[model samples]
Target: MDGLIDRVETERKLRNVWHWLPDAVSEFPIETWAELNVTVADSNAPYRPVTRFESLLQKTTTVRYLRPEVALMEPCFDVLYRQVHDGVDVTLIDRPNCHTYFLSTYPERSSELLQQDNFTVLEHDELPPYGTGLLDERVTISCYEQESGTVQAVIDTDAPPVRGWAQSVYENYLSDARPIESRL
Candidate 1:
């Protein structure tokens, strides 16, 4: 056919709109979380570790932190390696520009694996506000942040599994606090 149909014209409009509203009040405070973006790598260090960790992190759903140095990421990688062997899928979502969310179904296993010198177990209230409904369907998930450039993991208190996993991991970490010095 010479022509399939009549010609059509389309118009597109872009608008910038702003709104004013009152603040919200809740029993729990709404916290803020900044995206983790580590764009700097140590110039003196070899490029392998930095790219290795960055590549590993990128294999997951999404990761905010990037270009972490060897020293900063080595320990985390070690723990992650052990965690993997222990049957916990640890995916790096963020690094210490602050926090790393290990995307796994076994939060307890991940927590136990991460209980080391650099890793700390955090409570739900202690965590910054993440996206709403992020954990609604998740029964067990592990998320961590850093203290003084080290890694830490947290269990979602609102999750039913947290009542058991979080408490046990917290106790375990407190009972045995030691630094792990090894590489994968």
Candidate 2:
């Protein structure tokens, strides 16, 4: 009789726990616009977190950008330039190919951009073919479409684990990169 009572009690506890679980198929929004600082572009919905970074820049004292392509730099250049002008520390990492493209495409602007006291740009041969930005305590990741040459998606998160992982990746690349001025 004791065994039967124990089994019944266990089953009752299991049922209680099951009732507390969230519905997997529910249509409720998982995150609000403020919580999920994500932006999707392109036909396939790629991440483009530039707007989030721009907004975060207002409150950030330091900014780090890891970019693989020159084209990706154009959109955020104005915001970054303004931040650097306003005394925010900014670091940019990209490939040598991107440097060459920047110089060719914006010969005049490159001089002004590189001459800023608060700005530092580095080139790394082994930079992965994607973009990531660190603004203050938040991290934003941008993926691109190889064929369309457009941003696919940008994911922004302040989650501790995700920020830690992104910081690790940024540090690895930053260590391997050489200052663009040194190369010039």
Candidate 3:
């Protein structure tokens, strides 16, 4: 039976393909990062919960963040303040809007945040189209979909290519960014 043999061969190929697929069994979207002990730096959306970066700040020795929105930066101010006080190296790259928000709304606190020795604030006119951060060896990249107005983050700890790309993007931006004092 030629038809029967063909069916058997098809089934065998299907089984082989199934074995090659990854066995990911997690309910949360970014659970793989948690399993790998990778820190995720996600942007704060109005509808979503606070990002894990707040909790990771306690244990992270170094932090590099590119923040496009002032609202997203507000919640983590206190945590960053504490981390800088604890001698963590914190570098922030922000757009002009963030500086305006701080100077107009929270002048005193903003000054305190910028004046820390362990903290460095840089301003850029335009940044790469994504929000990205590095917490030690972990790299997180958030891209916004213009059509849907939705944001998604790709967090990786072990992938060399992803880490290299993130580092390259960060360094490129950092090179052209101006210090906050220069902007003042």
Task: State the C-alpha lDDT per candidate.
Answer: 0.28, 0.64, 0.60
TM-score of 1: 0.20
Tens digits of lDDT, candidate 3, 1-184: 6556554553443342232212321222332323233222234443231265456556689988875345445666777778888889988888876677877787887788778888888899987555677878766544434344233332334445555656777898899999989858
Give candidate 2's whole-model lDDT: 0.64
Candidate 1, residue 163: CA error in Å? 13
Ten contiguous residues minimizing lDDT sum, candidate 1: 9-18
Whose lDDT is greatest here? 2
Question: Cα lDDT for residue 168, model 3?
Answer: 72
- Give the best candidate by TM-score: 2
The residue pairs that clash in candidate 3, if any, are none
lDDT score, candidate 3, position 125: 90
RMSD of model 1, in Å?
Answer: 19.1
Report how far residue 99 has shifted in candidate 1, in Å. Answer: 12
TM for every model, in the order presented, reads 0.20, 0.70, 0.66
Runs in model 1 deviating more than 4 A are 1-78, 95-156, 160-184
> What local lDDT score does residue 179 receive in model 1, on the 0 to 100 scale?
22
